[model samples]
Target chain A: MHIDAIQTPAVLIDMDRAEANLAMAQDLANDLGLGLRPHVKTHKLPGLARRQVALGAVGVTCQKLGEAEAMADGGLADIFLPYNILGAAKLDRLAALHGRVRLSVTADSAETVAGYAARFGPEAPLTVLVECDTGMGRCGVQSPEAALSLARQIDAAEGLHFGGLMTYPPLGHGPETNDWLTRAKALLEDAGLASEVISTGGTPDLLRAGQIPVATEYRPGTYVYSDRMQVAWGHGTLQDCAMTVLATVVSRPTPDRAVLDAGSKALAADTCGAPGFGHLPAYPDAVVTGLSEEHGVVDLSACTRKPEIGERLRIVPNHACVVSNLFDRVHLMRGDEVEEIAQVTSRGALT
Target chain B: MHIDAIQTPAVLIDMDRAEANLAMAQDLANDLGLGLRPHVKTHKLPGLARRQVALGAVGVTCQKLGEAEAMADGGLADIFLPYNILGAAKLDRLAALHGRVRLSVTADSAETVAGYAARFGPEAPLTVLVECDTGMGRCGVQSPEAALSLARQIDAAEGLHFGGLMTYPPLGHGPETNDWLTRAKALLEDAGLASEVISTGGTPDLLRAGQIPVATEYRPGTYVYSDRMQVAWGHGTLQDCAMTVLATVVSRPTPDRAVLDAGSKALAADTCGAPGFGHLPAYPDAVVTGLSEEHGVVDLSACTRKPEIGERLRIVPNHACVVSNLFDRVHLMRGDEVEEIAQVTSRGALT
Candidate 1:
């Protein structure tokens, strides 16, 4: 089937662009002498994870245990979950998954480490990384002393092995994050703990991963399918975006406004600090001013030429990761032809 | 299984509260002498649509053709889709669905009427309502004259019947919307065209449906599962909210901050013009400050108590409809016990 034959409000992945993006990121990581562990949250396709692994990615990064399970079922060998996994249900799943593949997870608090310690045994220990808050302030230990304290807890736990340090640093704060990690590494070394794998990630500062000299692995999720946010942050151009929402101009309600079949459900509601919900590559001047659930209201007042009703258009959404999760399957396009329709193996694996 | 056994980041539908909300809305429409056609976009569960129909709903309203198809497949006899049916693919699907169920759609332009006229035939004439703008500034005919003009076009079409007028009016403008529909109905009467079904909808102003005396049918989507937005609009209270996102407190990175396992992928990014992304009924003073793809950050500075790690909490999202679209299945809870795990059949039916 051709790309045009597919229904509107469908997700289209340009395989050519996606392959090029994957190759570029891999090349950058190889040149910097770092392990590239691509986060699978962007595409959530095991086939793409395999492609990254084929291109020499160390493993894959997953945000949720369900996502990690899906990747493992798809034959992904090494998986790293940089999240604080809690509760008995998820811990049981984690232990079950641990028997199948090489699994490692992160913890920022002693309570999370205790849960892991109680779940696993020394027979096949789980690798636990200490998540440091290197200025991101979302999750992770507050200071180097706290990082050392958590590392010591993991080291002492019978069923857990202290893997290393991990941090999701803020964009453009490489030097500061580097200094913070340096302090944490020094503190860990002083306590007779080896910080073997220092991991840091964020697509905006992915190419500059080497700035943080203590980092051994770089985890970048959005680089697999760079979005409007990546483009806006100067990480790439619009041409580099691999995913685009195929939509139709359903209604031209007014002279200045045209509505598309896609809305927040299709393009998603994550804005890249931009003026519109998405970027229409064909009509760059057109701004998607508003979005209801199923109607993307495009402001065509600024454009000299506007789309008519029934005309199909492709939109590069604000965030690619969230958009991937919104759909069940995505069309892999080779130019205008449909190469394949791949299921998003972990589309709604929120747990 | 009990409600506590369900995993975190799960959508929980309180069936007790939902049945009460459905009954209240149906009773309101009955008292007002209006046909209650509840929109199924909130739950997107055919079972709920059946429940609404059992409680005296005239039919069900759907935003997309796929949703109407899902409802129809689940034995919903009457389905009203208040959206423009465009393109060859959708028109074909719409025609196929129309053959199985009583399907009516709305159109604002002659172009849409032409599409319906091309596909539908006199044997199974489709009902096409003229969608009026009525100050909403979304998809609709601009003026009452435009509504009449479109209605005349539908009446003139060989394969379509002029149903009436439909408007998704702005909230708190009941009298103005009533006057606009009154003029349009009068114009249709002057042209010897009877306005059979004057349909108007919006949950925010649903209780004021009687204020628009010209409306013969009232469509309320979110009232089935009232949300933070509904409560914020003074439509209902937090107790009336039937759906809540069950999440786990995964991290407490600071003294005044905590993080949940649910984020945009689970709870969604929509806000009710309120400060937080959601409302925690158990902790009314806590505010959801921010959300990443997999983490909902909470600001607990104003609260006297804070949630500990590994704790479970139920959050009422800002918008119920979008939250329904985010999950694949929802847990039906009768107070503290789990009733059933219902599938969100049309969760991502954007097309």
Candidate 2:
């Protein structure tokens, strides 16, 4: 099968580009002497995760247990889920997963750690990372004091091992964020508690991971498939992008407007600081001005030669991770030739 | 199975509310004396489509050939795809579906009609509707002249039947929209061209669907599961919403911040005119301030009672259609009791 033979509105992964990206990211981590634990949440394909591990990643990081489960089924051994696991149902699943793989998770509060404690016992201990809020106000404990409190709680728990500290820092706040993590590690040392790992991640800050100094391991998801947002953030150029949504021009209603088969359902509605939903390689100036569920409305006003009906184009979405979740299977491409088809093993694994 | 036993971050459909909403929409269409053709892109469940058809819909409207195929497999005889059918791959699928069911589609240009004419023949004629731009600046022909031209092309085509006209009008543009459709129909009549159907749709304007006297059919998808946007648009109240994302509060990082297990992956990031991502039923005062792939951060500063870790809450998302597409199966609930689980058979059918 050739790349052009594959249906439109399908995810096309440039295998050569992805291999280069994986090697580049791994080499960057190796040069920095930081443990590379590439997040599998970006591609969600076990085949890609295996490639990442083969390229010298210590393990794979998963945001959801279902993703870890998929990876484990695909023969992955070590997994780190840096999200709070709550409820008896989820905890039971977590406990079962801990028995299967070398698993660790993160918690920002005593309540979450307690939930983890109730599930895993001393016989099957689970490593727990204390998520700290360096600057990203999304998740994690607010301050160094709160981090210590959570770390102490994890240490005291019977079935849990206090793995280390983790933070998804705000971009460009590396120095101060490192200072904050350093203070928390110092406080842990003062209390005679050992911090095993210091994890930090963000594709935008993957190159600067070594600058933090305190972070022993780095988890970067989007680095495998740099997207429009990555280019917009100056992480990499558009040529570095591996995954593209293969779409066909479904309608050319006017000289200024051309509609594509890939819409919000295919490309996703995530506009992570991009001017539009996605960037078209064939028509660089055409803006993806609007998207309904199944229609991506492209504004071809700026383009001198507008796309016609049935003209296939590749779109690099704003956020690659979200776009991967929107599809079930992705076409692996080597140049214009089709390499293989890979299942998005953890596409809807949101449990 | 009870509702609480179901895992977190699942799509839950309130059966009673859904039934009520379905009946209300059907009754409204009946009262309006307009043909009801509910769009199946909202739920993408065969059971729900069957229910909608049983309620009095002339047929089902689909946005994708994949969706229409799913509906056809579910025993739906009449399926109208109001999206421009482009490319030979999609045309082959459309033609195969036409042989099995009474399939109709929309075309906004001559190229799309030509594709249809090449795939299908008079024996297996496909009903083609000229998609007109009723002021929604999306995928539609810009003017009444354009609509007439497209309709004339469909009529001239050997394999296609000029079905009628269709428009996804801008909300509340009934008078002028009717004037435009009426003028186009009059031109078709003057040219001895017959338009058997004139369809218009928008959940926000479903109540005023009859106001457009030229429209012979009304297609509304979100009415079955009205969302936060529906409430914001004054189409319905919060209680009328049938679909709710059952999410568990996984993290309470601060007194004011609580993170739910559902994020953009579950609730989706498609905020359709709502202030935040969704509406929390348990804590109406709380705001869904942030969303990552697997984490929905809530702001509880305005609330007196903060959500604790492990507490499950129901969130009504801003848009129901996109949320439904995010999940694999939707749990049917009967007043806090799990009734059944319906597969989203057409969820990712975006071809």
Candidate 3:
């Protein structure tokens, strides 16, 4: 179905903009000679991931064990589970995935490393990357000595191989990125080991990706689908936004207020205290004051161009990543036509 | 699958509590000699509605046109659409629904009444009810005269029937409800119309439902699946809550903070300014400090216990109605075992 004919409150991806975004990232990586391992958590659709892979993406990175499983099932040859997979259930799934795909995952503890080693022997080896805390206090080993020791222990595991050192840096370009990687490489060499792939990430530092030394790869997912929040953070322009939510004004309760069919169920509440619910294409200054399950509370006072009842409008959500998880299907639209139906393969695969 | 065996971030419905909640509401209506038409929007699952129907519920009420259509598809004989059906799409669906089952819908304006009349003729009548604005200035006609005029327009239409008048007042126990309904009923009689039903609804005021004079029916959906918010509102206790989101702490980023697998995708963003993402049944004081799409940020500093990364948690979300719309399927749990799975009909069905 076309954009106008399809039901309201459906996710619409502009394929032309998406292709432009893909080409922009691939071109940047080509110029810098960096391996592009795009994070698939931002857009869980296998069709979009396949387009990225076709555009010379080296591999796809997963945020969870469940996401990795879906990726493998979607015929993804290279997979990277960036989170620490804890519990017997998750480790077993990881082990099975490793046997099926060229898989690698990160870890920061001996307890977790030993658990993986015991589950899968050296013959059915899984690549282990020691996650370093390069400033984002969310995960990984704190110091170089601690990280080196953990890497040594992980490398010595019968079933695991020390693939590399990776750090998901804080959302900015900092000196810690250089100091930590330099210190980490020295410590690994001192222990007679190699940090084969020194990977660093974060969209805030993506533009300055080439500045980080000894980095073999860069992974940025949201750069391909710029959102209002991303634009506010100076990541991309409104012109770069590829995905938008197509909604209709279902309820015109008042002259100043109109409610759209798209809500938290379709938009996915991943707001960082933004101005509007989604960036209104026709009225950019409108604020989404409130949201019900199937209703988007829009405050059109800023724009003063009130949308009439049954009026169709396009909205770019605050965060594109969260919106992908809310829908099982998204229309890949080009101009007036729907090019294809992209299934969000691992959307809500939060095991 | 049992609670422990099922994957994390799954929707769970305690059948015992659900049945108890239903029984309490049924008994309340029976003792008061009132007709109970439970709203299906809270727990879109038909199995729950079936149980309520078996418990002597008169019919079911739906908020949107799509929900009423879904209830009709599930073999529900009577349904009420309590919102204004504005658009041609919704109008067409409302007309289509009249062919399948006995349907009643509310309209606050003459424009809306004319639209409904144009769709369904007298053979398949679109029963129109005047929505009264008793307290909240969200929707509905302002005064009894406006309601009377709207009712007259519906009664005079070729394909419409002036069913009655409906009012969803703010949760309270007072004489204002009696005054509003009394004035509304007098005006309806003056317009030469006999209102068949005076449908009133409010879970908070269900106990005081008898205060309204000559009201024939009441709609209370949340009573069938009590939530933590309902308990906080003094409607029920924590022991009465039937629905919960079972999630696991996937990340323990800090000593005081951990992240659960359930986020906006499962719990939704329908706080209405509640305390946290949800209440932790096992740990009462622990609060969900923040929420991302797939990460429910929890702070355990004030609580007596700490959550392990893999430990399962049962979260009673702030609003039960919005939570049901998030999941496509809900597992019916008895004690520790899962009895069956009920598909969430009308999930993403935004007409």
Q: For each candidate, what's the DockQ?
A: 0.80, 0.73, 0.38
TM-score for chain A in each prediction: 0.99, 0.98, 0.96
Quote the positional error of residue B166 for candidate 3 in Å. 3.4
Local distance difference test, per candidate? 0.91, 0.88, 0.79
lDDT winner? 1
Per-residue lDDT for B288-322 in model 2, tens only?
98899899989999999888888888999988998
Q: Report the C-alpha lDDT of model 1 over A36-134, residue by residue, as the tens digit.
A: 999999999999999999999999999999899999999999999999998888999999999999999999998999999999999999999999989
> Residues A170-282, candidate 3, lDDT per residue (tens digit)?
76654668788889999899888898888877665677787786788888878778788888777777888888988877656566677777777778665654675677878
TM-score of each: 0.99, 0.98, 0.91
The sequence of per-residue lDDT tens digits that candidate 1 reaches over residues B121-180 is 999899999998898888999998898788888998889998999999999999999999
Clashing pairs in 2: none
lDDT of 1 at A117: 96
With a 3 Å backbone cut-off (N, CA, C), the pairs that clash in candidate 1 are none
TM-score-better candidate, 1 vs 3: 1
Order by DockQ, highest first: 1, 2, 3
User: Could you arrange the candidates by lDDT from highest to lowest?
Assistant: 1, 2, 3
